[model samples]
Target: MKKWQLQDIRIRDPFFLKENGEYYLYGTTDVNTWEGNGEGFDCYRSKDLKLFQGPYPVFRAPQNFWADRNFWAPEVWKYRGRYYMIASFKAEGRCRGVQVLISDDPRGPFVPVTDGPVTPTDWECLDGTLCFEDDGVYMVFCHEWIQTGDGCICAAKMSGDLTKLTGEPEVLFHASEAEWPVIHREFDSEGFVTDGPFLFRDENSRLHMIWSSYGEKGYAVGISHAQKGVIGKWNHERNTVLEKEGGHGMIFEGPEGRTLLVVHTPNTWLKERVKLYSVEKLILGG
Candidate 1:
């Protein structure tokens, strides 16, 4: 095993989780994330964002696992004394959807909590991110454009235990509703892609979501502010948060307490690498 710096690691949909002063990095870790047999997910730990150690194997598909490919966007959330990995999976005849995996430790052999995807089994969905609100726990995920000509971001209430979805999913917003995302004409003339819907708040505690889609410069990240609350009307920022072939980002408080954003850049297969940025700088520049 070898220790690698930030630039040395090649991953997509980079997710940052800080626990006990150490940073844990998780993402789409398979050698070929687009296709081929999915091997599961690996994690990296670092005291600082500069250097990291271990591609510690946190998950591997079991013999009975229903999904054999497209293991994408694994993000871990700590809730009720345990860590849950919200990730997406796919199979030949089955529709793509997100599932919940559980473990007592951050670095673990996580086991499936939900029998399969908590999202609707028949819908094409991905990037299931956990969001805790005063009312209840929720999972905000993308309904991919691959299935819908116009992609959407939706939210569904989860059981107190995070094991299963409690009710029908409600659409938060569609990719076409956002002003910044350009139609991915390559996929469909009217297609608009939606990926990585992550929830966060500003200093005012106003809820906002950052999601990825095609922009003027290929894959880009955009921020949308919720008008009422977590599941309220969302208004997209006129400009994208990151506009240069980088997307699928997540934000976290750095060790120094600075707000940081992490995204995979170049958005090209095998050429992607994690790029860290100051959220303040991005907002100021955008």
Candidate 2:
């Protein structure tokens, strides 16, 4: 296997997952992510974060697959002994939505568990992340600003088996509700965009979410605290945790149990590379 330095990998919405003793990385791997025929997702693995091996193909659209373009943000989760992938997909005439895929291994050839997206067929949605609670499993996703002027983070209950959505999605919050995010005029003239929504709990067990939108500088990432629980009221931090042309991040406990935040920087096609930040330094001033 050919080993590549982390700097050599160009990806977007970088999702870092640690399983067993190895770190696995997944993301939008296409060379041209904006427009073109959709390519499947891939994964890279490393014992240490500095170097990786393989663009091991994890998923590919099968014959008669519903979506032809814009395959984005594939997040893999281990649930009940199976690996589940929640990712966004869109065809030329269809509204973009998140779909569920499954595999038995972390480095996978993941296959869709559903024929289409679990999100409502009529709604434009993306970045669907799984949130497990005592009550049930929920999928937190973005309702695209292109369809709604103020993009929203919404949650919907998923069946215990994780094959389908059981209820209508409940809006958790909108991009405009946060003080930092500004209208991304170039992308959508009348909308406040929301890119990614990732949920994590603090040391005290209080829920928090980190998501991205255009801020004072450019694309940025910010944290919001949940007043109650997963679907409860959220309070934005008023300032971004990361900015200067980077956004769409996720948190993971890396080697030696260090909590790290990973995001693609420059917000430019092909130039983007995954960068890591310490959560303590970024948020807690540690």
Candidate 3:
């Protein structure tokens, strides 16, 4: 068996699931994702986070799939005894949008649950993540700034079957809204770039979010908290949660019950690597 290494995968927007003492990783796989020709998503399983096995082709593009390429960030979650995936994709002349897929297992042959992308058809969106609340399941995603001068994060309620959007998206926050989100060299004449929004609940029963933005130091992760446990009123933390060349993070508890943050490090396409960090409980003091 070939020793599992990160080099084997040219992946971006990585997500993980810990199941039955094994870690299953799924991500956008393509030779060059920046040019956006990703075929589909794949899965890798590892007992120790290192030494992965199987580049199992979990999903293949459907014949009439609206998005032909740029398949990104396939995140799977166990909901109602089934597996659900929220992934980002792009079509020939359309902006990148997040879509939902369903499967029977973590390492799955996932199929689209909805007709097409769940994000607003008129707006550019990406990095959609599933967040459950008292009302129902919500699709929290980034409204790409590439199309708009200012990038924003928004959330919308999904229908009971999780097959379609139920209401208008509520703007949670904006890239310019965060004190820590910064723009490096102007890309496309716009000064802001926003990506990846993952929802996590800390030990204190507080709702928190971790998202990515570019800065002088390269891609970085910023943390924000919902004071009232609602999506619309997120308050950005003054300090970044993780500033070392990494972003697009997701939180999961390991077998030992330790919260771990998984993200791609060295942000650039040429040097990206899957990195994990043990999350420490942050105590806020006046």
Candidate 4:
């Protein structure tokens, strides 16, 4: 059997799930994520979160799928006694968008639940995550600044069956709206690239979101809180949560009932590695 090490896996947009006494890690596993056409998403399973097993082929691209490359950020969750995945994909000319996938198991050959991407057909977006609030399901995703030069995170309500969008997506915030998010490339012309947006509510009922962006220092994680418990009314925090060239983080519980944060560190294609951090109890000030 092949041994598992953090360096061995070339992944982006790392996500974690604790189920049945085990930790399952999922992400974009294309060997050539930065260039060239790529393969489908894969996952790894571990107990201690240090050693992983299998580059398990959970979801494989169909023969003539519309989005043949740039398959990224596959986040799975258990809902209604079934497994659902919100993942990003790209095609020949269309911009990246999130689509839903369904599976009977966590380690799945997740099949598409949507006819096509869920984000607006005219908008460029990526890194979609499912958020349940006020008895409704919402798909929160990032509108690629690559196209607009001002990336923004937005959310749209999903239909009951999770097969389609229920309403128009609402603009939550822009990459430039956050005090910590900055533009990295001065040459490319696009102001900033806002990547992943993961949502979670803390024990005190404070809704927080962690998203990725390149700042004055480097690529880092910026956090924001929802002042009124509404998804779109988030106010930016002055300080970033994790600022050491790491991002695309999501919070999950460990087997020991501890909250943990999973994100890819060194945020560059050549130096990225999956890292886990213990979530400390902290209070959010309004």
**TM-score to true structure, per model:** 0.97, 0.98, 0.93, 0.93
The per-model lDDT (C-alpha) reads: 0.90, 0.90, 0.81, 0.81
- For all predictions, the C-alpha RMSD in Å is 1.3, 1.1, 2.2, 2.1
Candidate 1 residue lDDT tens string, 83-150: 99999999999999898999999998899986788888889999999888999999999988988888
Q: Show model 3 residue runs off by greater than 4 Å.
A: 6-10, 184-187, 281-286
Ten-residue stretch with the least lDDT total in model 1: 181-190
CA shift of 177, model 3, Å: 1.4
In terms of lDDT, the poorest run of 10 residues in model 4 is 277-286
Candidate 2 accuracy as lDDT: 0.90
Q: Per-residue CA lDDT of candidate 3, range 26-138, in tens?
A: 88766677675567777898887767888888898888888877778889988898889889888888877888899998878999987788788889899999888998998
Model 2 steric clash pairs:
none
Ranking of candidates on TM-score, top first: 2, 1, 4, 3
Best by lDDT: 2
lDDT of 1 at 186: 63
Report the backbone clash tally of model 3.
Answer: 0
Once superposed on the true structure, which residue ranges of model 1 sit more than 4 Å away at CA? 186-190, 284-286
Candidate 2's TM-score reads 0.98
Cα lDDT tens digits, model 4, 1-286, are 4659766666788988777877788998887775577578888888887788888898988776768788889999888988899998888788777889999988999999866888887787899998888868988898888777888888888997788888888889888888887776644675777888888888887788888888777878888888865455788877777776788988888757777777887777756788777777432432
Clashes of each: 0, 0, 0, 0
